[model samples]
Target: MYCEITYQTTGERWGIFPRDIGEFQARMSIPDSINSGDSHDTIVKKSVKIEIMSCSFTPDEKNKRHREALEGLVDRLVKAGWEQMTERGAEWYNIKFHKEMQK
Candidate 1:
């Protein structure tokens, strides 16, 4: 059996901190048994795409410093293993950041 998994964030309130985010949703389409003799190689081959939609934000000089500080904090978190997804093909991983004010 073939399957796909998707993860998304909803009702998100983007800010300088990670805790300011909202709920996350993940959908999985995979077999229950690993002994089914099927391979998940295709899932790894298709490449994963992440999308953030319907977002708006603007930063001024004051907020710019805050954003930069947030970036450094996120970098430390990634090094600490906060990452949820990793690529099988690459030795390195990917992370994304956004500058937005959530209401």
Candidate 2:
């Protein structure tokens, strides 16, 4: 599966795999490839995308992970920028309410 991570601030985007979809993971970590910042606090996160192929996991598990990943991104984005939005394929989930961001 393929996914995209769009930045609401710089409008910069990138593509990542399943493990790269969440926080504290290797790809999005402070010392991972594609990292644009030196510190975690200064790192800018615009959005994250994940692809799930098979039905090995339950819906609840999938939802939980997705939410956790999103929340982590929001936390990072709060310090990086105020305006951010995420679009999971065709569905859009606004994290501005949880963390005061422009959109």
Candidate 3:
């Protein structure tokens, strides 16, 4: 099984590939540095999409289940204020607010 996790942030769209649903879930559950209270930012808001592909399931029922799981995770993250950021946006944010972000 292959899972593609897409994160659409303020100005960036990032894609993460997880080997399976378990890995995807695990990654989603882990908090980033900003969310862990190590950074000044309160929340990182991001829109998420998960795409799953499985060869075993003929009808691909597993994909639906995976999508549901991903949706749940995304909802949780959004509620927590995890905003998405594009690469250029991130760079600009970093450069524009490097001093604040560094703290």
Candidate 4:
């Protein structure tokens, strides 16, 4: 399973997180992966889509359970001001954000 983050405004991709960040409350909350670490900075407010792909193949018990977990994660994140991207064909968001974060 995978979870991807993107900036909705510019269609810029943030980063793609695997099941490591997909587990329920693993980092205490899914959005913590995107947090600035400075509480005073505040959330970007502009919406972001945290897309989860539980299956790139035919469904199976493992994938089904994975999908369920992703769905729950998405729901919790959405309530925290993020949104979901339902456009299956949406292009990848900008890669620079991911690159910069690596530095």
TM-score of each: 0.22, 0.31, 0.30, 0.28
In angstroms, give how far residue 10 of model 2 lies from its true place: 20
Instruction: Score residue 44 of candidate 1 by CA lDDT.
Output: 19
Best by TM-score: 2
Off by over 4 Å in 1: 1-62, 84-103
RMSD of each: 14.1, 13.0, 13.6, 14.7
Give the range of the ten consecutive residues with the poorest summed lDDT in model 4: 93-102
As for candidate 4, its clashing pairs are: 12-93, 12-94, 13-93, 13-94
Off by over 4 Å in 2: 1-51, 54-62, 83-90, 94-103
lDDT of 2 by residue, 37-69 (tens): 643423334435433322322112347655665
lDDT against the true structure, per candidate, is 0.31, 0.36, 0.32, 0.33
Q: Order the candidates by TM-score, highest first — what do you get? A: 2, 3, 4, 1
lDDT of 1 by residue, 14-49 (tens): 455322222111222334365766533322111122
Q: By the TM-score metric, which is better: model 2 or model 3?
A: 2
- In candidate 4, how many clashes are counted? 4
lDDT of 3 by residue, 1-103 (tens): 1112333212222356322222222122223556574323332322243333332211132456545654565565545444433322221112111111222
Cα deviation of 34 in candidate 3 (Å)?
16
Candidates ranked by lDDT, best first?
A: 2, 4, 3, 1
Model 1 RMSD, rounded to 1 decimal = 14.1
Off by over 4 Å in 4: 1-62, 87-103
